[model samples]
Target chain A: MVTIKDVAKAANVSVTVVSKTLNGYSDVNEDTRRKVLKVAEELKYTPNMLAKNLKQKVTKSIALIFSNFERANGKDGVLFQIMSGIYAAAVDFKYEVVIYTRSLSEQQNISYWKFCKDHKIAGAVVTGLKTTDPYFQEIVNSDFPCVVLDTDLASEHTGSVSTDNVGAAKVAVEFLISKNHRKIGMINGHEFAVVSRQRLEGYKAALSEQDIDFDPTIVVNSDYSEESAYELADSYLQEHRDVTAIFFASDLMAIGFMNRCREIGVRIPEDISILGFDDIVLSSYTTPKLSTVRQNFHKLAYQACEQVIHILEKEEKGRHIMMPFKIVDRETIKEL
Target chain B: MVTIKDVAKAANVSVTVVSKTLNGYSDVNEDTRRKVLKVAEELKYTPNMLAKNLKQKVTKSIALIFSNFERANGKDGVLFQIMSGIYAAAVDFKYEVVIYTRSLSEQQNISYWKFCKDHKIAGAVVTGLKTTDPYFQEIVNSDFPCVVLDTDLASEHTGSVSTDNVGAAKVAVEFLISKNHRKIGMINGHEFAVVSRQRLEGYKAALSEQDIDFDPTIVVNSDYSEESAYELADSYLQEHRDVTAIFFASDLMAIGFMNRCREIGVRIPEDISILGFDDIVLSSYTTPKLSTVRQNFHKLAYQACEQVIHILEKEEKGRHIMMPFKIVDRETIKEL
Candidate 1:
C-alpha cells in the first residue's frame, strides 16, 4: 500500500523525482535515489516486485488503433458496436485498453513510435485497412504481437481477426435472389480494403449462381458515405432502369440508396428492393428498415482480443482466426 | 528484453503459470512459483513498470462512463466527439479507458461499479448526467479522483471540465441577429443537463440584447437527437409560421431541423434560415451545409486531461477550466 506520494514526501522531493528514480529515467541524483530506495525498501515497496515483479512479464494492456472512429460514416454502425464488444471483454479480463488514432501514414510523420516505445505497448488492434497503408509493413515486422480487424494481414508474428467477409457478402446477394429479384445493382465501398474486394467477389458469385449476367454498368463504387451513395443511387436509378433490386456494401450506403429512392418517387421494396451489409444499429431503425448481412462485430473484436492475448501469452494455437457472419432479414427487401 | 515466454521456456512451465505466480493469483503451485521466479530472475525478465504500478495501485485505467451512449434518439453529435477526445488523452497519458454503457437508471444495478472496482479503476469520467441516476451520489462522494464532463454533477467535485456553453450559444444567436433576422426560433437539448440550460439562457440573452420580446412559445426542448428533435421541430414549425430563422442547440438536431423543414416544403435560408451548434464533421457535408457554433473537441479533451492529471498529481490546481467556442458560417444562414 506504499504510494509514490509517500516516498516523495519522505524523500523531500517531487513525485516526478521519485518516479524518475524508480523508472530509471536517468535524471535524478544518486544520493536521492539511494535515500528513496532505502525508505521504499523499509515500506516493503513491492511496486516492482510481487505486484509488479521484475520477474513479472505480462502488463495485460493492448492498443486499439483506428482512424477517425467517432466520425465513421452514418452516425452509427458495426464499427462502434464491435469496439464496444472489445471494451466489454477487456473489462471482463480487467485489462486496460489504449485507443490510438494514428494511421500508418500519420504514424510515419508523428513520431508516435517514440511514444509507443516509451509506453511499452505489447500489442495492438488495427482497423480501417487501406490496401497500400505504409504502416502495415511496420506492424508485420514489429516485435509486438498484434490482432488485425478487417484487414487480411497474414503473418507468423501477428494474429489475424475478422468476420468471414466472402460468405457474408454472398449471403446478402443470395437473399435478394431468394426474394425473387433478378436484375440487381450494387453500391460498393472504396476498393482499398480487402473486405470490399471479398464482398465484390461474393456479389459476382451470387449472380453467377442464379445465371444472372453481371453487368458493370449498374455497379458503382462510393466513398462509403451516405451522401455519395445517395448520389450514386440516384444516378443508378436513372441509368439502370431495368434493375429491380440493389445490394449495398454497407448499411450507410443502403440508407442513402433508400433516401435517394424516396426522393425520386421510388418506394422501397415496392419499387426497388434494397439489401445491405454490416447490419448495424441503424439498420433496424431506418424506416422500412434494411435487410442486410449481419457481421457480429462484438464477437469479432472480443474473440480478437482473447486470441491476441492468447498469442501474446504464447498459447501457440494458430496465426489467424476468423469470426462468423450471418444474414439478418428486415423490411428493405421484398418478394419480386 | 526478456519476456514471459522466455521465462516460461527457461523454467519449462506455461506462461500462465509465470503470470499467475507474479500476479499472486493464489492458484499457482508454490513449487511452480519458486521455479518461475528463479528462471525469471536468471532471464532478467521485467514487466512494464507503469503497467505494474497500475496493478499495484489502481487499474492504471479510467472508465468514461456514459448513460446509454447510443442515446435512444440516434442523433450522433458533439457528445461522441468529446468521448473521442477523452479517449485520445487517455492514450497519450498511458491510461487505460473502459466505456460503461447502460441506461442512467440501470447504472446502479451496481454491476458496472463492481466491474470498475474489480478492475481497480483509479477514477472515472462521468458523463450524461441525469437526476434519476443512483450511482451519481456514490461516485460524487467517493474518495476516487473523478473528472466530470456533465455540468449538473452535484457541483461538489473540484476536477470538472466543460466548454463555455453560454458564451458559445450567445455567439451563435448574435450571429443570426447580426445578419438582420429578427424573428428567430430556438432548439434546446434535453432539459436534464445544466449545460443545455446555460445555452438556453444565452439564447434569451441575445434576444434581450436586441430588446426583442422573449418568446417561450418559439422554444422547443427535446433529447439531443435527430429523430426526436424532428418531431419537436416539426411541431414548432407547424405552430410558428412566421419565424424566419432558427438556432438549434446541436448539429445533429440542426440536420433534423432542416430535414423537417424539407418535409414541410420549407426551404433552408430562402424559407427559414437555420443555425446549429457544435459544428460536427457532418455539418460541412449536410445538404446546404450547417452554420453553427464550433468547439475544438481535440483541444478540449487535451485540456481536460491536463487538468485532471494536474489535480491528481499536482495537488488540485485549476479546479474549473472552460474552453472557448466559435461560430462557423456555412450555407444554411442567409445574408441580409
Candidate 2:
C-alpha cells in the first residue's frame, strides 16, 4: 500500500505539507496542494484515518444525536431530511458523520458526552430533544462543541439552529386572519418542547395584533402524535363550532385533523379552513393540499452542521442561527 | 480519564481479559466479564475508539454506501427506512455506522475500496447500485467483506440481501389476472436495474402460465422517475385502450401513472386497474389507496447489515438471503 511519505517524496514536499494539504488546511499554497493531491492520486495513497485520528486524539467526525428517532419512523420525513442535510454538509467539510440515536444511548446508559468521547467525535448536532430531557441539561452544561436544533441554547461551545418558529407561526396565523377568519382555533404540540411553546407565543401574538380576543379554551395541546391530534380535533371541533379556521402545530397533526373532519362530515375550507406548520411531504397530497408554514428542515440541519464544524475547526464561539421560513398557501385555506 | 489498565487492576484481571470482556468477546469467563464491566462502569472508563481501532488495524464500523441516494430524497422514504434499519442493527451489534453517499465519492473520484481502506471500515452494506455500474463489479470482485442490497452477487467476501422480487411480482400480476383481467399492460423501470428485469420476467411468466399471449408492444420502460412514467403513461394509455389493468414496476411509477390517469379523465379500477410494486409511504395515501407488493425495505437493510457483520466477525462465507414480501390489497384493483 502506498503511504503519505511516498506521496510527499514524489511531490517534492515535506510530510507535514502533504498532510496539511490532504487534510484541507488552508495554510498550504494552492499549487503545492494540487501537486501533492496529484502525487497522492497517482501513487494511490489512502490515508489511514484511524491512525491519524488517534495521533490527533480527535476524529474528524461529527455525531448526529436524534432523541427517540424511531418514533418518527415512517410517520414524518423531517428527521430524514435533517440527516440528509447533515450528511451533505459533512461531505462538503470532509468530515465523517457518526449517528448516536439517543434512545440507544439511554438504553445503554451512556451519556452524550461519553458517546462522543468513546467515538472521538469532534462535535455533534443534536435534535429531537425536549428541554425537560436529562440529556438536554447535560448538553447545555457540557463544554463539548455542539449545535442544538429547535432550541435557542448557545454558549462558548454550544451553538443553536432553528427556524424562527415564533415568527413563522405568527405569520401562519396572520395569513388565516387576513382571509377574514376572526375565530381561529389553535392545536399545538406538547408544551415541553421549546418550539411548541414558541409557536404558541406566535399564535397568541398574531391574535393580539389583530385585536381578536385570545380564547384559552380554543387552544389545546397534543403530544405531537397523529392519534392524539385526531382525538383532540374530534372534541375541539364539536365545542368550537363557531371557529372559522384552525391552525395545527404540525402537518401530521393537520392530517389527523383532516381525517377526523372527513369522518365527522366536515368540509375543509367550506366548514373550517386549516393551516399547518412543517410542510412535510404528505401535506401536498392531502385532500385539499394543506396550507402550511414551511420550515426548511434541511437548511436548518445543514446550518447546524456548519455551525458545529465552525466551532470545532475555527475555535469560534458558538452563535444562534435562525433559518428562514415560508408560508405555503394551498387549497386548505379559504378567502373567507 | 480511567483506562483499561485501571479497570483491569481494579477487577483483578489482565488488561487483555478486560479488553475482551468490555468488547463483548465470549472468550472471557462470565464472572471476570461481569467484574470487569462493573469496575469499568464504576470508574467511568470511556474507551478511546480511535486508538483502539488504529491498534486493531480496522475500525468496529460499517460503511453504508448508497449510490445516488439524493434522487430519492423526500419522494420515497425507502432509503430512510433502510438507513434506520442499518442503524438499529449496528447499534445492536455495538458497531458504528459511517455513511458514504456515492455521489460524493463520484465527485471526489474515490473508489469504494479506497474509501474502505482510508476509514478502515470493517465491512459495508451497499445499496442502489446498477449492475453495470463501475463500482458494482469492483465490489463483487473485491476481497473486502460486504453485503449488497437488491442484487444477487455472492462471493467468499460478499453477501447479498433482497426481497424475492421475481416471486412477489408474479404474485402481483397473478392477483390482477385472478380478477379476470385478460389484457394487461406493463410499465417497467429502467432496463439497467436488476429488479426491473426480474419483475418483467415474472410478468411474462404469469402471462405464459395463464395462456395469455405475451404482447411485447404493450410493455414499456421508464427511467424509474415519476415524470418519465407520467409521460410514458400518456402515450401508452392512448395506444392500449383494450388493456383492463396495468402493472407498474414501482409505487413511485404507479403514482405517476395515477396522476396521468386523473388528468386524462380515466378512472382507476373503473376504466383501468393498476398494481404496483414497492409499497412506498405515499401508496397508502394516493387518491384510491394503491394496492401493491410490499418489500420489507427495513428488514432487508437490517439483514444486510447483520450479514456483513457476520462475514467480518465470524469469517462466514457470504450467502444470498431472500426476505419475504407481501401483497397489500387496497383500493387500486377491481374485479372484471
Question: Which candidate leads in TM-score?
Answer: 2
- Which parts of model 2 have CA positions greater than 4 angstroms off? A4-42, A104-108, B5-39, B104-108
- For all predictions in the order shown, the interface RMSD in Å is 6.5, 1.5
Clashing pairs in model 1? none
Model 1 ranges with Cα > 4 A deviation: A1-78, A89-126, A129-148, A151-164, A171-192, A210-336, B1-47, B50-63, B72-80, B100-124, B131-144, B150-157, B257-261, B264-271, B281-288, B334-336
The lDDT values for all models are: 0.72, 0.87
lDDT of 2 at A294: 94
What is the lDDT for A16 in model 2? 97
For candidate 1, the TM-score is 0.64
lDDT of 2 by residue, A70-182 (tens): 78676578988998899889999999898877774483587767767877888999988877776887888788999999999989999999999999999889999999999
Clashes of each: 0, 0
